[model samples]
Every structure is written in structure tokens, then in C-alpha cells.
Target: MSQPEHDAYAASPRTLEVEDLHVSVGDHLVAVSGVSFQLRRGEAVGLVGESGSGKTLTCRAVLGLLPETGEVDRGSIVLGESDDRVDLIAAGRTVWDRVRGSRIGAVFQDPGSYLNPGITVGRQLVEQLRVRGGLGRTEARERAVGLFTEVGLHDPAGVFQLYPHQLSGGMLQRVLIAIAISCEPELLIADEATTALDVVIQAEILELVARLRRDHELSLLLVTHDLAVVAETCDRILVMYGGEIVESGPTEQVLTDPRHPYTRALLAVATIGDWTRRTLDVIPGQPPSAGEEMPGCRFAPRCRYATQACVSAPVVTTEIGPGRSARCVRLDELDTEPGAVLVQDRIEATA
Candidate 1:
């Protein structure tokens, strides 16, 4: 079948909408707060940030797979279009059972941990297809093999009988991808899915995902700390910091001309695209721990441009351009031009 046009899918309704989400680990400790974004049909959005930025927590909330102590303290996660919109927070286990794996699928960083070592990878996939897909045993097996082949696994039938430990890391990842998309879900969440792979394998896996998205019209939520991965795969980028989004815009615009100081700092450290070999820069200080109760801008302490006003009051997200917004108290005073925030000199001095 011919692949659908990108523009055709762009006009479709949103697949997921998260509004002012707040996730708390316990009575205190709000791990994720005031997070909001929308994923249009067939669109791929990357949520990028350093560790402890709540990227995984935000994705977990969307998937309704938060830890035992984690709970949605406030906010609504609406899934599906207007006609069939469902608030995931209000939806009980029964609703979740019906939604997860069928409408929404997820792939995590470690594929091995999710699969059973005792069972053949193919059998596990077949079981999922039989249970969630409602396929007969024979049909499920056939579908499993087909999915394996579709994901670029060589000798699908032969590989099906092998245990999880029998396959290489790249192959295991492909198996995980096959299982994730076996049900043909509308939304696919890949949380640092390629972090464990080498560069060549990572590129291959990313290409596979992009092709699948194009062919199946699947909306993707990619979570990762790697800016280069996001640059290559995502249409838009959401830069997270201290449990909140600090900057968001088109991928090209955000990469080339970040608005927030935090975003610029990240670019300084990231190795994106082809460039001459040079010492990489690093942001100073540690990111705030989850629910650390930052009264003002969370990034103010590490931001060189932060002023009294930045630390005196909470920062609000301000629109700087079309489809672009940033949360920074000194957005007007700072220079956000490409390569304007030169951290190389500081790095050299420290070195």
C-alpha cells in the first residue's frame, strides 16, 4: 500500500491532550507539575531534558503506568478525539485495561527487563496478540511472525523460538518494537528506547520508527535526554526542566534558536549534527531534585543571566514567536541568538 501523505495526517484531530498535569510521589514531593501538551494524529513530539526533569514521569502519567506511590495530584489527561474523548485520570482500571496496549502502546529503555527470560520472545508476543488483539492461536502466531518480519528481524520463524537471552541487544529492541506496534495502536510512547544501543543501531532503530509512523499514521511521544536523537526524529521539541517545560517550539527553530537560557545551556552541551572536533561544554550545578519546592524560576540558580526578579517570583511561560513559548523571567534581557551563549570559554577556564 502507498504511504499516506504527511499533510493529510497533519490535519487530523489530536490523539492525546495533557492539561496542567501534576503528579506526586507521596503526600508531598510533586514530581511533575503544570505539564501540558498535545499530540496530533501522526505527529512525533520529543520530550527532551536532563535527568530528574520529569520526562519519564510525564510519560508514565500519560500511559497510566506510574509507580505504586505515584498519583495524579491534579490535571486531566484526555485521550482520543472529541467524539470519543476519555479522561484517563477519571478512567478506572477497567477503562485502562481497554485503552492500554490497544489504543496506546509503550516501549521503554530496557527491553530485556520487560520480557520474560524463561519464555521465547515470540511466545510472549503471540500471547499479547491473542489477549489484546483477540486473535486465534494460529492467527496470533502468524501475526507475531509477520510483525517480527515487519520490524526487520531476520528469520522471523527461527527467532520466534529463541529465548530473550539468545538475541543481541539490537534484535531484542526490534522485538520490543514489534510487540509494541503489534496491536496497531494509535499512539506509541518510546521512553529512551534507543539509549542503550550503539550509534549505528540507534540510527537504524530511529529510521524504523519513522518509517512505521509514516506507514501506520501513529502519533509518537518520544522521551529522551539526547538532543541529537530528538533533532533527527521529532517534528517538535519540548524542553523540560525541574518538572516543567522551559521551552517549546518546532524542532529546527528550537535547535537553531533556543529562547530560554536553559535551552541554550543544553545546546552548548549537546553534540548535534556534523561539527569539527572540539571540547564539549557542560552546564554547571545539579538540577533540582523532584518536588524541591522552588519558589521562583527553577533554573534561576544555574542560569548566568538570572537576576533578582528571576529568583524573587515564579516564572511564567511567555510566547516569543508563533508556536513557540518559554518560561524565563529574563527572556527580554538575554541574547538567544544561535551560538550566542558561549560556554566554551568558561569550560576552557575551568579546565
Candidate 2:
């Protein structure tokens, strides 16, 4: 894919800063707690964990599309830098109307669901172009076709007239991507965007995202449960569990020398480059329920190295290395070298 012309919006720094964000559902259930991360301009960050880990909630919180029963209880989600920054949590409808789609674009898992079934996909993109891009009808139509082409769609003009259901999964996703980047948003949040597709399609989507990020200089917050996906596409990784980030660092560093037990466990089970068929290792215990209170580390119950110290008091997130942090009471005790025995291997060896 070729790089598009640099627009005024692309010149500004678009940094997504989420600080101590807490999301609450219903009256008292805190679905996300103390979750924080930053995505700088032209950077790709992956938020990875098993389901029920509040990844979607965090994404929703940033997008201001949380369910009616859910709201940000505390913390701030600021976009942009310096005088141009806007706190999404405090922003009202007017601010949100200007921010979403225009400033920050998102592509979710179900592309068909987000699109209007009755409207032709091309017309959908055209509407966004006209409304958000402030282009005339003719100009919007031309730009929409160009966007479809930019996203690598075949027969872009022909595909424009098809409804959501008329397209294949990969094609629909591409259409969604066309709409997402049509406004030239600086930040793109892809929440499980490739989860529903097959392996080949998934790889295509990841490559497309990477290309778009490079061409557009767009910051990416890719939310997924697959570490392999992060390993391939993201520059940094945030390993989330039970509503909080358990470990975060440069992708290569964390994958090779994981400081947190939960991260190691995830790496052990992940099918990254190991093509040899074998029994898949599984994390021994279930993730804690949303808003489930725990005395110490959230993953202590499942961690093989956990002891009384790990459960007696809340584990504080500590900096283990440059730009690397993990929430574990036993971080010092654990081996942080590459090829270290994983917790799962230890369990299997004993069993």
C-alpha cells in the first residue's frame, strides 16, 4: 500500500493517555479498575488477555460507547497533546460527536453489525465522507471509492453498491477499514477486529492494519486475546487479567523475558512459531469474576510461584526493567531470562 498525502491532522500529535481508568457497570460492579496505558503517535500497542479481562470495556470507555448501564467511575482518557487534548470521560455529546469517527476511528470484531444492513456499503462510506470529511456529494462518492481501493478491495466501484451481507467476511472488514480511515483519524482502536476471521484472513487484516498505520501515521490500540497476534503486529504489549494490567513492556522483551507469572503462562500456551503438534497447555485456573475482590495478586491463585506474600497483600506494579513493569510480589524470585522454564512446564513435570 502507498502512503497517502499528509494532511493537517496527521501533523498533530495524537497520543491516547489513559490514566487510572475505572469502569463500573450497573450500580456497583467495577468491570475495569486502575487500567492505564498510552498509545503514542505512529505507535501500535496491543492489549491482550483471555476473555472477561476488561479489554473490551477499556476500549468502550475510550470510545465513549459504553453500555447504558456502564460509565467511567474515575480517571481520565485524554486524546491529543498540550492545548489540543480532550478528556473523553468528561466530554459531552457535542465533544463526542466531534471526536468519534472524526478524530478517533474504530473497527470492531463484527463489521456487518456496525454497518447499516439496508444501506449499500459504498453509500455508507460516502455518508461518512460527506458528513465527517465535509466533502460535497460528488467528492464524497469519489473519495469513498478511493478509500475502498486504498483498503485493497477489488472492483471498488462495484463493491460500493453491495449491502453488508453481500460481502465476504474479509471484504466486509476491508469495507469497515475504508470507512474508518476515510476521515483520516489520527488514532485507530481495533477491538478484536480479526477474531471472527480465519487464519489467512486474520493475517491479511493484521498486515492491512500495519500498512495503514505506517502510511497514515495512525496510532493503534489493538485489543485481542491472542499474544501471537500482538507478537506479530504490535510494538508494545499490555497483558491484562481480572480487570487490571498484569504486565506491560516492549513486545519482544515481554515475550522473551516475561516478568509476570500470568504473562509467562500465556506465553507457554500461545501457539506462536511452534508448528509441531502437541497437547496444548492450559492455564490451571479460571480468571476471577469481574469486580471480584482479591487480597493480593489477581493471578496468585493460579501462579505456581505464588506464596503467602503473593496473597497476603495487594501486589504493587513495579518496574522490572526499562519500560517494563509487572504486578507480582515474587518478581525478584522468578527467572527473567529467555528460555526459562514456564509455570505450566513445572506443573506438568511434577504431575
Candidate 3:
């Protein structure tokens, strides 16, 4: 009934809980605001939206890896096993260091940039295993080989001895996965992990991640702009806009029956079928820059259903369905079905 009650019901044995998160750069640039979400143990959550919507920033905040200028002005990142929640915003370096790799791991977009070119893959992975899990060199090497094999890498021994540049993109991604899960973290933050790969490779990587999750029983925070990817890999979705979560709910509920105008627009033009004659639909106008303060709803400028109330009213999340909410005043009046608009050419092609 109340927000607190809904949150209490939703916060069931959370592996990661981010409440009222506010991240800012320098003085006035608020990168993320009033962001809140939870990753249940062994569940996958998708933070989906366009670039600069604070998806990556939210993940970074969870991992205590914010940029030097960035600061958590408000909110708390509560993370741990059941009944062991720790507010990471108040935690010091010692706490962060302990939790960063062993308790929680990350797999960023590009393996090229994240992995070292000079170091052998096995060496880097061994170092992580040794440092994070405190294994002896011999034990760490054995663990590294097992991790490599677990992530679907062939010839684990041979691959481990090679540098990052020597491997293909898919192999490099597998290596990254091995490194991320080497310590068997409880939560894994994957920020656009499949963005750089081709379609076939992307699918393979997605499958690998899904299998790894099953094997490891890790909670996943998948941050990406691709709704399709989210649909395929995540169980829940959080749609962000202009650094705030505009809509959030079950993945199927949000995708097939989006309540927010932004979410609907995203679905309308998703190259669903027969794209040869279909011109992709695009959201009008541009998203506001990070920390760009707005008087009202940030998507008001591009929303076709926007009105004076939308532009003037104080924005807050209203529960639309079970465990689902949207940050809009006119949620009641908006159409429940996705009104994805396509180009005239697409309409004719369909006819």
C-alpha cells in the first residue's frame, strides 16, 4: 500500500540493495538521482535505457568504483548475504577492497581495455585468485585453469598462457568471465558485456553468462541499452531516463506491456520482424546531459502525451502493478499497451 510497505515486501533477502541513490560529479552535475533497486540472491536484474541514463554509474556506485570527481551525495548501497546488509556508502576502503572482487565482481564492456595486453591471461587471473581469495600460487593456478574451463574456454592451459591480444573477442570475453567469477562472488555487475561482439558471438556470450549464473547461483546486474539483450538474459527490468528510473517491473511485463511512454517508444521500433521495409522508429529530441537539473519529468520534451501537469508536477514513482512502478503523474490516464509508432513505409510494407 505505502512505498515503505512495497519496498519491504520487495526487499526479500537482497543480495544488493540500492536505495535513494544520488551520484554527482563536481558541484552541480548530478549523474544519478533517487535511484533504488534490489538484486535478489541468484536473480538477474536489467538496468536498461539509452546511454547516459546512469545505468553504468549505478553499477559503479554499487562496486565503490566511482570516478574521482563523482560522489554519492545521498542514498545507500546495501550489499551482503541474507541478513548481512552493509551500507557501502558509509564504508571505508578496507570494506570496499574486501567486497570488490571476492564478494562482488564486475565484467565491463570491452575486454581489450579491461584486460592487460602484456600479461598472460592465466597470470592475471591467477593474481586475482591469489589476491582476492588468498590462495597460494600453485593453488591459484589450479583454480585459474578450472575457472577457464568453467567459462567454456578450450585448452584452458594453452589459453591461459596467451596474452589478451592473442585471443579472439569471444575468447577474451570468456577470459573476463573467468576472472570475474574466479572468486565466486555473490553478485556480478555486467555492463554491456556483449556490446562489442558480433551477433553470433553476442548470443554465445549471453548463453555463457546464463549458464555461469546457473552454475554459480550469482545475482546479476546487467546494464545495457539493448532491450532485446535484457529480455533474453534478465528476469526484471529497470528503465532509466535522464539519470532516473522511469519505469521498473518484471521483464515481460515491462517489455510487452510498458506503461511509460519511453518504454513503449523503445519497443515500437525494435526490428521485430521483416525490417527490410521498416524504417526504425526513433525517440524524438535528445536526452538531457548528466546532472542536468530539470524542473519536471526529464522525458517531458519528447513524450507525445506530455501536458502542463507533466511539466510542472513533482515527479514520484507510483505503483502500476505488483512490484512495478513508474515515475509519472499521468500513469492512470496513459494507455496500457505499447503505442510504438513506426514509419509510414513500415505500415505500407505490412499492408
lDDT value, candidate 1, whole model: 0.88
Model 1 residue 149 lDDT? Answer: 94
Off by more than 4 A, model 3: 1-11, 81-83, 272-278, 336-351
Residue 252's C-alpha lDDT in candidate 3?
Answer: 71
Expressed as tens digits, the lDDT of each residue in 136-184 for candidate 1 is 9999999999999999999999999999999999999999999999999
lDDT for 346 in candidate 1 is 38
lDDT, candidate 3, residue 120?
97
Judge candidate 2 against the unseen true structure and give its global Cα lDDT, from 0 to 1: 0.87
- lDDT (tens digit, per residue) of candidate 3 on 1-351: 346755765766678888899999887599999998888888899998888888888888888999988888899888875566678778767898888888898988898799988899999999999988899999999999999998888999999899999999999989998888988898999999999999999999999999988989999999988876887898899999988999998787777677888887777656533346346567778999986767889999999889998888668999886788899888889775444443332335665
Deviation (Å) of 192 in candidate 2: 1.0
What RMSD does model 3 have? 3.8
User: What local lDDT score does residue 48 receive in model 1, on the 0 to 100 scale?
Assistant: 95
Candidate number with the higher lDDT (2 or 3) = 2
Writing each residue's lDDT as its tens digit, candidate 2 over 1-351 gives 012322332343658989999998887788899998887789899999989989999999899899999988899999999888898778766897798999899999999999999999999999999889999999999999999998999999999999999999999999999999999898999999999999999999999999999999999999998877887899889999999999998887787677888898888887666545388779998999877889888888898888999889987899776567899877777875565664344434555
Model 3 worst lDDT run, 10 consecutive residues: 338-347
Candidate 3, residue 76: lDDT: 86
Q: In model 2, where do residues sit more than 4 Å from their true spots?
A: 1-14, 336-351
List TM-scores for all candidates, in order: 0.92, 0.91, 0.92
